[model samples]
Target: MRAVRPGSARDRPATPTVPGLLAARASADPSGVALTVHDIGSLTFEEWARRSDAAALGLIDRGLRPGDRVGLVFGENEWIDYAIAYCAAQKAGGVAVPLPAALPAGELRRLLAHSSAACLVHGEGRNPPHTGLWTATLAELRPGAGSLDDVRVRPGDAAQILYTSGTTGEPKGVVASHANLTFGCTADPRRRPLAHSRHFLHAFPIGTNAAQTMLVNALDARPGALTLPRFTAARFARLIEAYRVGTVFVVPSMAIELLNAGVREKYDLSSVLLLGSTAAALAPSVAMALTAAFPRATIVNYYTSTEAAPAQTTMVFDPARPDSVGRPASGGSLMISDGEGPVPPGTPGEVWLRSPAEPRGYDRDGDAPGKVFRDGWVRMGDIGHLDEDGYLYLLDRESDIVKSGAFKISTLRVEAALHEHPAVADVAVFGVPHPVMGSAVAAAVVRRSEVSTVELRAFLTGRLAGHELPTRWLVLPSLPKNTAGKVLKRELRTLLATPEGDDAAHSS
Candidate 1:
C-alpha cells in the first residue's frame, strides 16, 4: 500500500462553490454528457448549467433570499430534477436541505422544522408532506430570464444541510459550507480521482452523502455519472455491462446483495477498473469475493460519516491487511483517542478525522458539550486502532460493542467471522438484552442456504472468542436497511424484542 499523495493548492477548485463547479464544467465541456439516468435520459453540462441557472432565477422570483433554507425532496428516479434543485438553491444564495422521500411524513416534518426551511422544492409525483411550508414542484419553478449576479455566494457560506441516518437515535442535521462540499473539486479533469474512467455507475439514493458525492463528481470528474432511477442488483449489473463502466461505487449492503445474487455471472463486468465500497466497512470476505468477481478491478473500501465527509479513509484491498479501513486519504488526519488523549498503536479507541476542508457540524448543535465535533476533529464514534503501518482497523461502533459479564466484544469482529461461513450470505451482530449479563451478543443472519444454529456455532468456534459468539441467533430473509443501504440496527433490536424473534433460534 502506498501513501496517498496530498493534493496541492493548484489542484483545488478554481471556483470553490457548487454552482461555480457546474459553471466551470459547462464552460470547459458544454457538449459533454454530465449525468445519465439509465433508461430515462441524459443531460449535458451546458444543459444542466443553463437549467439550474434558470431554476435559480425562478427560486428568487418565488421570494427566496440569501441564507433562506430551501428543503429539496425528490425520489430516487428524480435525480435530474434533484440536481437542478440542489444547485438552484445555492445559486439563489439559499441553503439546500435534501430530504429523502422514503422518510415518513412525521419524520419529514421534524427535519423541515429543524432546518427551519422556508420553502420546499419537490419532484413530480412526490407529495410534499403537509408541513405548511411554501412548496413548489421542479416544473412549477418556471425558468425565468435573469442572472444570479445579485446573490453573493461565497465559499464559506452554508451550501447544504443533510441529516444523519438516525440508525442509533434521532437524525441530526449536518450543515456543510460551500468550501466543505467543493474541497477537492478541480477545473482540470486530469486532477480528478476517477479521471481515467469515461463513466462511473452508482445507485445511491437521493438525499444521501454518497449521492451528493456523485453529484459533485458529475461536475468535477471527467467521467459522466451513470445511475438508475432505483437500484436493483440486476439493473446495476446491466448498466455496468452496457456502458462498460470503469469505476463503480456501492455500500457494503449493495455489494453483499450483488454478490449474493451472482450478477457477475450474468453480466460482463470485466470492464470495471475500480470498485469503491463506502458508508460502512466492507467485510473482508465480501471484498475478497469482489476481487474474483471483478477480476481487473481494484476493490477499495471508503470510511466516513455524514458528519465527517470528504474527509475519509480509502483502502485499496490488500489481502495481507483486509481488516484495515486504511490510512487517511485526501490530506485528512486520523487519530485513535481514549477520551483523555491519543492511544498507542494497536489499542482500540474512538476514531477521529481531521480534514483540510472546512469542518461540518450539527446544524443547531453549536459548541454543545460532548458533541462529536471537537476543535477541528470530527469524532467518528467508532472504535478502532492504528497499526504500525498507520492503517486504521475498525473494531466496532462504540455503541455496538457488546458488554456481557465483564467482557467487551466487537460486533464487527463477530460479524466478520460469521461472514466467512459459506452458508452465511449476510449478517448483523448486535447486543441483545440479557438478565445475567448487562447485554449479550446477538446475530441476525441472512443465509444463502439453510444452516442451523449448531452448525454456525461449530463454524465460529475457532474464529471468535467464547464471549464474542452470539448467544442468540435470528434467521432473516433479508436485513432491514435504510435508503443509503445501511443496516438499521435499531430496527433489528426492535424486531428482536418481538415474541417471534425470541423463538427464531438460540444457542447457549
Candidate 2:
C-alpha cells in the first residue's frame, strides 16, 4: 500500500481542498482541457484555475466569509460556471450548497431556510423568486482584476451540503467536510483505474451527489470530463462516439433504457473502458447487458447513501456473484445489525457503516434525534447481509421491504428478477396493503412489446419462488421517475389506489 503524504511541511502544496487540488492540476498541465460541455464550450486547466480563483476573489469582494453558506441554483448549461462557483465558495472559505433549479418553490424555500444560506446564485436568464434571501446571477459575478490569495481552509471545515433525493422521506441536507470530499484523491496514481481513461462522460444533474462526485473525479482523474445538458439513451450513445469517451457513469435506469432501446448498436462504444453505476443497486440482468455492450470495459456498481458517501462499497462485476454490491472499499467498515447489535453472518439486518469521512449529521432537521448515529457508526437504514467471504448483498431499504403473509420480500430482488424478462423495459416492485396477508407484493412495469401479465408470470416461474413473485402487476406506458431516475413509489401507490380508470386506461 502507498503511504499517504502528510501536510506538515511548509513547502508542500495545499491539497485535498477543492481549489488546492485544481491549482495543482493546472500547474501540472496548463494547456490540457479540464471540462467540456458540448453546448457550453470547454475550459482548459489553466483557464479553469484562473477563472475559479477570480470567482473566489469576487465572492470575497461580495462579502462572503468563512463559514457562510452560498447556494448555487443551476440549469443544464450552467454546469461549468457552477463548477467554478463550487471551488470559489470553498476558496473564499464559505460553505457551498447546491440547489437544483427544478425544485418546487416550497422545497427551495425549505432548503434555503434549513441551510441558513446567505446568498443564492443563479445562471443565465434565470431568476427564481427569493424568499428574503440575497440572489445573484453568474454573469454578475465577474472575474477579479488582480491576483488574489487562496483561503487556508482546514481539512475538517464545512465543505458542501448535499440534499437527499427524498426517495424514502423528506429531503435533508448532508454535511460534508473538505476531508470527506477529498478522501481518495491522494491515492497513488499508478494503482488508480481513473488514470486509464482519457475522457469521462456523464449526464448527472449539477445538484446531485453523483454529479458532485464526478466533478471531483474530473479534477483528480485523467484527462477531461464531458457532459450533456439533458440525457437520453441515444444522446448518451452519440456523445461516446463524438468524444471517444473512455469512462462512462450512469444510473441503472439509463443502462436499462440503453439496452431496451438498443442504442449501443447504433454507435461505436468500443472506446469505453469503465462503466459505473451508483444511487441504487444495478440489477444483475442490467449489469450483464452493460458488460455485453461495453465488452472491454470494467463494469462497477458502488453502494453508498448521500449520508454515507466517501465511505462506500465497490465491486467490479463478477458474473458469478452479480447479486453482490462488492466488498467495502478502503477508508470504511461495514456491519449488519438487528437493533441490539451485530447480526450473525448470512443474517439480514440494517446495514451500518463506519468511516472517517461519514457526514456529521443532517443540518437543522428535527428527525435526526434517534439511534441512527451511534458510537460513530451511521445506521444506513438499508437492509442487507454479508456472505462468508464478506461480500455485501443489499436486499432493500428497511422501509421498502414488503411483509406478506408469513414472509418478508425484497422489492429489489423481485425487480431484479423481473428485469431478466426480455420484454420488460423498466420495473418497480413494492408492497401494497392486503387485508388477509398483511401486505401483498405489487409491481409497476413498463414493457417494450405486447407482454401480458400471464406471459411475464410464466417467464418468472423458475427465476423466483412463489412468495417472492409480485402478485399484483400494473403494466404502464412508463414508470414515473425523478431527475435521478429513481422510481417514485409514493406516486405509483397513489395511482394504484385510485378507483378511476383514467390512469388505468394508460396501463394494461
Candidate 3:
C-alpha cells in the first residue's frame, strides 16, 4: 500500500499555519488597505491589525482565553468581524468555531451544546436566536480601543472547529489546524493569499467551510478586500464594477440567481478574473452558461469538502470531459480504491485523499484522526474514480449511491443526465425503500413546465444507461436544500416514504 502522499505533506513548512502568515503580511503592508465592505470605508493593514488587536483585547477583557472555543456566528460578508474574533482567539490562544447562519434554531442549539462555545461575536442583527443565551455584537464589544502588537502563536495548534453536515445527517465540527489552514490557503496563485486582493465578494455570511476557504484568499490580500453583507445579485454586479473586484467564489445556485436577476451586463465585470465555483459539482450546461457570461474569466470547478478542503486527485485533466471536477492543485495526492485495495484505471471506488489540506479531525469522530488522518491520508466518504491522465471524477457521496438489484448507481450521473432535458430546472436523485431490491432509484425534480412521470421517463430513456435511470419520479416545486445548497437526499427520501419496484422495465 502507498503510505503518506508525497506532495501535500512534504511541502508543509515550519510555521505552516495561517496566523503566522497574517502576521507576516501585516508587517510587510502595514499601511496598506486590508479590509472593506460595500460602500463602507476600507481599513488598512495597520487599521485591521489595530481593530483585530482591540477585538482580541476586548474578548480577553470579557475573560476569553487561549484554548477556549468561541462561536463565530455571523453572516457571510461581515466575516471580517469573525476574522477579528478568530485572530483575537489566536492571540489569546483560543479556537474560533464558525457556524452557518442558516441552521434552524433547534439544530443551532444542539451544535452550540456540542461545541461548548463560551461566547460569540457577530455583526449586529446577525446573531442566532439561541433563546436562552446572551450574545454581544462587535460594536458593543468596545467603543474605542487601540491595537495590540503581535502575540506569538504556535503552528499545529487547533485554530477553528468548522462545522459540516455529517454523514449521519447530523452537523459535525471538523477541527482545522493553523498549519493546515495556512498551507492550503497559499496553494493557489490566481487565488493566492495576500494582505490585499484587488476585490472580493461573498454572497452570504461567513459560517460554512466554503466561506472559510474564501476568507483565506481575502486576508492574504487584506486592506484591499471588501465584501457585501448580503447577496444582492444586482448590487453585487455593481460592486464588482465599482470596486474593480477581481476574484469571486460563488455556488452554482447563486450563479443561476445572478443570471436570473439580469445583473451581469448592468455592471462592468471585466475587471474580475478568478471565478472559483464549488460547494457542489457544476453542470456542464451550467458551466457553459457561466462561461458565456464571464467570457474573460476561467470558471474553475474543483474537488473539495468540509473534511478535506481541497487537493489533488485520482483523475486525469481533460476539459472536454465535462463531468470531472478539474485537475488536482499543484501539490496534492489521491487514490481511488474499492474498500479492500486500490482500483485499476477506469474502475470506481471511494476516493481517498492525502494532503496537508485535510482537516486535522472532527469534534466527535476520533476515527477521523486515527483512521482517516494517517501519516497524512484523509478518507473522504465520496465515491469516485480516476481517469488515465490523472484527474478526479466524483460519482456521488457513498450514502447518496443507489443500490438496486445488485447494481450500484450514482445519482449525480442521473442528475447530470436529467439536467440536459429542456424542461428540467432542478432535480435530486436518491434511493427509496423497495421490498424486492432493498432499495429503488427515485428522483424529485423542479421543472419549467408540467412534466409527467411518463414524459420524464421517456426523456431519461435515451440519455441514461439502462440501470442508471430512476425507478420512480416525483415532481416537486423545488428540491429541499440545506443552507449550503446541498440537496438533502435524506429529506427527499423521507418524502418518498414507500417502496417502489426495482424492475428495470419501469426505467426509461
| C-alpha RMSD of each candidate structure in angstroms | 3.9, 4.2, 4.8
lDDT of 2 by residue, 1-508 (tens): 1111112122213337777678878887788888888877888878888777877777777777788999888987778888888887888888899988898888888898889998887787886876798777755776555335546787767789889898888888877777778776753445444676778999998788899998888778875889989988998999998888889999988888888878767989999999999988899999999999988889999988777777789999998899999888886888998877888889999998766552445666633345565545677888999999999999999988999989989999999988888888999998888889998888888988888887787777898889877777777888888878889998878777876523552322
Best by TM-score: 1
Tens digit of per-residue lDDT, candidate 1, span 1-508: 1111111122233448899888988898999998999877888989899888888999998888899999999887788888988998999999999999888899899899999999999988877668988899878887566668788888878889998888888888888888888988887766877876889999998888999989998988888999998888998999899999999999999999899989978999988999999999988999999999999999999999988888999999999999999999989999999887799999988999988787787787453564577766888989999999899999999989998998989999999899999899999999989999989888999989989988898899988788888888888889998898888888888888888777775756
Error of 2 at 408 (Å): 0.8
Q: On a 0 to 1 TM-score scale, where does candidate 2 land against the true structure?
A: 0.93
In model 2, the runs with Cα more than 4 Å from the true position are 1-15, 142-150, 187-193, 356-360, 366-370, 500-508
Q: Rate the local accuracy (lDDT) of all candidates.
A: 0.87, 0.81, 0.68
Return the clash pairs for model 1, or none. Answer: none
Which model, 2 or 3, shows the larger lDDT? 2
- Total backbone collisions for each predicted model: 0, 0, 25
